[model samples]
Target: MTLDDLTVSLRALRLLAADFGHLPAPDVDVSTVFPERLRLSFHDTSCESLAAFEQWRTALGIAPDAVEARTQSEGRTRVLAAETSFAGAVVMLTAYADQSAADRAGGVR
Candidate 1:
């Protein structure tokens, strides 16, 4: 996806926020889902991996100012959150790493 386009595409920017450090850098698939919607996918979907997407985006020098990120606790779960526009709708992209899934994968908790 074009960085220039991303600067103006708030929806795409928000979706990407939750996927920054979670996905492999410089090697991802981007697709347009509709008139103003986009989709991005990358490697590494493990529940054990934990990282902020904004860090990766900032490091790449392509992060937008529209997305705001923070961490919060839902009962006993820690969820990563990115609030922004998605597909013309205001939404918060939240990702929860499944510690149980990580345990099943032999990953240290």
Candidate 2:
């Protein structure tokens, strides 16, 4: 993935966290990028859980179609979605967080 792709992915995950946190405790946060890993559980990764493996796979696979792209800061912040395709199709969403800010404030996410 390019730097641009990594940014898009970051914003997408931030959005996902905000959206998902409303469900319950054990909020899912953006775990990693480059390879794009999302921590699917609050428990340990090595725990011997029957459904953990499948859950992890599902989190990485839920890209929505029509990956929309948008900028947040003065052309610095960028966001993306895998929603370019029609509904029911897989979204290959991706993002970029602004590196510098005049006020040193990060974008809204």
Candidate 3:
């Protein structure tokens, strides 16, 4: 996805959040070139939001197609990665542990 594509995708997510209200707000950073990496870092990971995204992906039947991966987790830190396509664009949801453990993990997600 190009920068423009990234913008449109984020707008769609924001709109979806408005409707469902459980989707976690995204903090995105994108590059302008090809081989775009759309990394969505959710600082405040909530169980409800994670479940909502999982259910949404499963309902779309993309869960199986979606790649499930794990991030580095140790101590009191936890990280999860769920990759699913949205509007034909590859979207990755990365959730880090709660605020308290963020420091030790060094924002590992």
Quote model 1's TM-score: 0.27
The C-alpha TM-scores of every prediction are 0.27, 0.26, 0.48
Candidate 2 Cα outliers beyond 4 Å, as residue runs: 1-5, 25-33, 44-109
What number of clashing residue pairs does each candidate have, in the order they appear?
2, 19, 0
Judge candidate 3 at residue 16 and give its lDDT.
44
Instruction: Using lDDT, give the best candidate's number.
Output: 3
User: In model 3, where is the ten-residue run with the lowest total lDDT?
Assistant: 29-38
Question: Of models 1 and 3, which has the larger TM-score?
Answer: 3
Deviation of model 2 at 5, angstroms: 5.7
- Put down candidate 2 lDDT per residue, 34-105, tens digits, no spaces: 334433332322222213323322454543443354555565554443322212222233333443454236
- lDDT of all predictions, in order shown? 0.41, 0.39, 0.51
Give the C-alpha miss distance for residue 16 in model 1, angstroms.
7.0
lDDT by residue for model 1 (1-109), tens: 4544444345555555555546544233333333243333222244332343444434334346543433233233333434444445333333444344444455332
Angstrom error at residue 68, model 1: 7.9
Q: After superposition, how far is residue 88 of candidate 1 from its true place, in Å?
A: 7.9
Question: Candidate 2: minimum summed lDDT over ten consecutive residues — where?
Answer: 82-91
